[model samples]
Target chain A: GQQVMQIPQYQHVQEGEDFTTYCNSSTTLSNIQWYKQRPGGHPVFLIQLVKSGEVKKQKRLTFQFGEAKKNSSLHITATQTTDVGTYFCAGPLKSGYALNFGKGTSLLVTP
Target chain B: EAEVAQSPRYKITEKSQAVAFWCDPISGHATLYWYRQILGQGPELLVQFQDESVVDDSQLPKDRFSAERLKGVDSTLKIQPAELGDSAMYLCASSFGEDSVYGYTFGSGTRLTVV
Candidate 1:
């Protein structure tokens, strides 16, 4: 079975600080997607990386996919309170269409 | 923006009791998935449906868990004899495609607690 693992289970940062979370997959992935889940809320789609050595940016956030297609990272610049949540990275299952999600990195930004 | 609809934002049941959750995905979306999230963890896929047919259920506990999307529009998940360990957030998500090529749209989810 494929497994997606995330580093830094929890992070607490002051407002205006930067934050980053890393994700690694046990097997090569066709693609990887990132999601953000607010406290007590459902996961929301953030971005998807399909190409090897890809990098995409959205506002203050940046996402990178490794050349091997087995690792990814999300970095947020100048974090704000609204950025507080758990970030998860998911990859497609080897045997099916379902996704295998990493444990997630919980972010807490304080004012 | 269309949304996935889920019923009963929360639920609490006595151990050994039965509980059910419902979900309605966005219109015309052909892929639906049910996932369970334990506290402080990522969502784990319970089942997946393509149209009205099930594509995966390997992680679902068949002994006490069941799910169906009979008409390929809305779906239901049932847990019989729920146990304390069954406490978790049950999420339903839908995507326009069968794979992660298109990201998922998730419902608010049903938080369940078994006492």
Candidate 2:
């Protein structure tokens, strides 16, 4: 069975600070996707990285995929209060179509 | 901005009672997934469906949990004789394909509380 691990289980940052969460997998992944779950809200789709060593950006956020497709990272520049949520990285299982999600990094932004 | 629809946003039941949750995915989506999320943890895949057939359910607790998508449009997840350990959030999501890299549309999950 494949497993995904995430770093910094919990992060509390001041407003306007930077935050980063890293994800590593026990096996190579075909693709990696990021999701955000607001307090008491369902998880929402954020982005996906497919190509090896690919990097994508969304405004103040950036996502990078490792060259080997075994890891990924999400970085938020100048985070704001609205960025408070748990960020999760999910990868598809090697034997099946279902996804295996890492224990998410809960981001808390202080006012 | 289509969304997956879920019913009974919250449920509280005693142990050993049967409980069920429903999900209706966006139209034309070919794949559906059921995930369980415990407090302070990420969502874990319980099962997945491709149209009317199940693609994966290896992690599903078959002894207590069962899911069905009889027509491939809507889904139901049922817990028979539920237990306190079953208290968690059950999420439903849909994608355009089995391996959709574009991400998925998730329904507002059903929060179950077993006492």
User: Top model by lDDT, which number?
Assistant: 1
lDDT, each prediction: 0.94, 0.92
Native-contact fraction for each model?
0.71, 0.75
TM-score of 1: 0.97
lDDT of 2 by residue, A1-111 (tens): 338999999999999999999999988999999999999999898998999999999999999999999999999999999999999999986745877889899999999
Clashing pairs in 1: none
Per-prediction DockQ = 0.70, 0.72
Give the alpha carbon lDDT tens digit for every residue of B1-115 in model 2.
Answer: 8999998899999999999999999999989999999998888889999999999898899999999999999999999999999999999999997557668889999999999
Give the count of colliding residue pairs in each prediction: 0, 0
Predicted complex 1: CAPRI docking category: medium
What fraction of native interface contacts is shared by candidate 1? 0.71
Q: Candidate 1, A43: how far from true, in Å?
A: 0.3
The whole-model C-alpha lDDT of candidate 1 against the native structure comes to 0.94
